[model samples]
Target: MLSICLIFFYILLIISLTLFYFSMFFMFNDLVLFIEWDLVSLNSSSLVMTILLDWMSLLFMSFVLFISCMVILYSDEYMYGDLYMNRFIMLVLMFVLSMMLLIISPNLISILLGWDGLGLVSYCLVIYYQNVKSYNAGMLTALSNRIGDVALLMAIAWMLNYGSWNYVFYLESMKGHFEMQFISWMIVLAAMTKSAQIPFSSWLPAAMAAPTPVSALVHSSTLVTAGVYLLIRFNNLFINTNLSKLLLLFSVLTMFMAGLGANFEYDLKKIIALSTLSQLGLMMSILSLGYPNLAFFHLLTHALFKALLFMCAGSIIHNMKNNQDIRGMGAITLSMPLTTSCMNVANLALCGMPFLAGFYSKDLILEMISLDFLNILIYFLYFLSTGLTVCYTFRLIYFSMSGLSNSMSLNSISDEYYIMLKGMMGLLFLAIMGGSMLSWLIMVTPMMICLPFYMKMMALLVSIIGGYMGYEIFKYKLSWELFLLKNYFLSNFIGSMWFMPYLSTVGMNYYILNMSYKIIKTIDQGWNEYFGGQSIFYYSKNISLLNQMIQNNDLKVHFYLFVIFIILILMLMLI
Candidate 1:
């Protein structure tokens, strides 16, 4: 069955890659493939299934298919000898299908099919381990995502007022319609949850409880990108809008928060996961600033490199017998030189190193942001996040790939990892080359580039400083880290995601849990015990005792009854 799935992925990959060039030549304009159902109309609105095969969707689909195929192949080795390998593979395939569905559908109703499918299938994959941690993470992932699903549903309902469920028709034309403007906000909110923007970000890191392959695919490419893609498609509606301003605010915060969290995080997968969060923030913040194309460019490039990053992490984790903490890992480059080199490439790309895939989109986004109207705080955060990205990544490298050799001997290491290595090779190439190719293909109307030298080199400068800091902190054992010792609470606060997992999980449910406690106290314990069975039993027992006394025909009972009757007669006479 795994073999069959791999064959299917390979065929789809071939088909999508073929369409890549064809889509560029042919789909210069938006082409909607409509499968209309004239027989079904509601409130004079036409019901149709629509697929929009523009360059954007086609290119994104091709990339998704390519990465997904690699992920499937990687899973073959990572999941070797598992009891439910077939189930895992099918779930991944279904996940890819859902992503494809999401990519093609322009009609809101059609989108719901794919949107809901992505959420449901992701839940299954997150809980694949069938353990407590996996279960909790799955719930967080599903429920956080369900917010977007519900938001989309509401957006779909709102579009009914416009007499059509096809949102593609309304993107540009409906901007002047003040009443219809709320729909754009709804869509942004929906995008926020799906993209794991601030207040909705707890799930992304927690979701690392899933297998590394799922983490690579879902976190890097498909599931989280769904929201960003939706926003990219809906960019026309957000231009010059206040909602876009709000989106910019949240996305920047999210980027900074995730970068900050990554520096503090210890888990190897979580460091990558938080980095993914930070990149999503970068994408979201850029889209919020009205550069949807740049966001899309970054999104694609990010997918390529981030997927490679996760795959490298998986290779290391698998070889280390599942030890994921950086403290437990060292000298990975010694044992797995190929994997280490690939990991370094992916990390360098993420840092927007010269001419790499991430550099293309990331540099463009940062440059554009500098050109845009901005204040000090937002501007500072933008650069700070770039630095912190490098900070955490170099920190990761220093801990895992360099320093003291803590790993087992390097013998037989290269031979044992051929399958996983093969899978990563394809992604590694794309991570290196996909940026420049996609940049040329997608960005036809390039920005007018002009910047002072210091401004232009801002990203690079920060990256250099961040790298030095990471190396020094690990090498010298920084003083502030020890200051955290004096302030253990503060250390844990930042280290524990500012307690977001606690807050998102426990704080979100605080009110409902208290209400439940009240309900139990009032109904189940107090009212139920007194009135349901206890009261009835008490009265019945007393009556039975009275009956027993009467049936006994005791002399004392008769005397008391006669005395009570005489007293009543005397009282009546006195009245």
Candidate 2:
């Protein structure tokens, strides 16, 4: 029964994707009609020829669907025997539907609707375990997303009020307008929050409390990437504002900060969580530089490789009875040969090793950076981040699969868990060789100038050397003190930042409710004492005789009564 349902779901997904891609292709040729509707009428208009379909959207959609499909397949084994399996699968389907809607949406409203839907389903999946920790994580994710949603709403409101609601209208009307610049900056803020860029990024690492499949889905394809997709979709709006430079600065900060966090993280999932933030920063930097194609290309490649890596990590955890601490695992490579191989390839790809999907896409961004000095600074951050990625990836893999002791191998790893591992390996293979095959498709636009073959080769060499050196230096354990700098201020700051939201939330709730309760109680006591308790009844009784006298009708008496009644009514109203 489950198999039948899964098959039907996939069929619907494939059909929808096929139709959508075909429609997009036709749109590129100016052959598609814009369907506009009013309350009583429908209008169709022709579109102008566009280069939007050159490669970026196509490649991104392919990656989105591929990772999503693989995640679904892996979940079959990962969630096996779990009672909520069907419910889990449902959330996965809904997530995919939302992502597809987002990727194909032609305007900002549609994209935001899709984004909100994605957030809803992702929150459901994150808290699917229904435990306190999972609930906390889900709430944090929702709260952070609300910040982005509100920003988006404000930006949309401004655009509408300024007569630029529609994409075409906005493009036509926003000529040298300073308000548009402000609107663009707000949108960038929205993107940063959604992408889990720093200051707003703590939610992501906490989100590791979710299941591995949820982690894979988020880190690879859906929720986080939606922000980047939004940026690419609105690339023209961003080009004219300082928002681009702001995005670059934030991206660089997020990349380095996340790298530092990854280095200190002990839990395997948290390490990957931080790494996801770093990779997102890299993608945003490329996009900020107006290289949407390159950013999208890297986004796709990152999705494939990262999902594979996460799924592989999930399988290892499952085999080890849900253990996620790297320190607890060691020397399992000989026992879990297949899992080790998949993990190694994924780590290499993630570290941007030569000939992998990451190599082509990452180097493309670096090539763009070489054209300008500011870009070079951004690329330098990325280059340094590559070293951190290697350090963390190797730390994880080596701690899990390579060490010199039998004490580390308590339970033999299972081949039965290889279903997800095999799925990941399949993705790993594609990530390793897929870029060369897709190079022609990605290089069609003028933005994609070919780098010298030797330079590309040299870039590959540097990445490999960086990875190797990172492994050599950090393979053995080091003192925690080595990580602490200047009285451990920075680490303390990050830790506090992670906990600040929860602390502030609890503190604010207590303060407001407790303080309000005390103030109200004090007022009640004062009223009781002043009026001898039962204040309303006492007031009513005392005024009853006076009210009756005021209502009595006699010429001169009534005139005086009317004046008193008016004053009484005014006092009552004021009270």
Judged by TM-score, which candidate is best?
Answer: 1
Which ranges in model 2 have alpha carbons more than 4 Å from their true place? 1-58, 162-164, 172-175, 375-380, 405-409, 445-469, 478-491, 494-575
Residue-level lDDT of model 2, residues 183-291, one tens digit each, is: 6777788888889886687778878877898789889878999899888877887774577888888888888778766766668888888889989999988788887
CA lDDT scores, all candidates in order: 0.86, 0.73
Listed per model in order, the count of residue pairs whose N, CA or C atoms clash below 3 Å is 0, 0
| TM-score attained by model 1 | 0.91
Score candidate 2 by lDDT. 0.73
Cα-based TM-score, every candidate: 0.91, 0.80
Candidate 1 lDDT, 1-575, residue by residue in tens: 54754676688679768868666865566554445546567896655566777777878888888888888888888898898988888898889889899888877777888989999999998899899999999999999988888888888888989878778878777787864688888888888998899889999988898899999999777999999999998888987878888998999999998998888788999999999999999999888888888898999999999999999999988888888888877776867899999999999999999888899999988899888899999999999999999998899999888877665555334426787898899899988998998877777676578999999988889899988987777665457568768889877877777788888899889888999999999988888989988899999999999898888988998998999999999999999
Question: Over all chains combined, what TM-score does candidate 2 have?
Answer: 0.80
Quote the positional error of residue 38 for candidate 1 in Å: 6.4
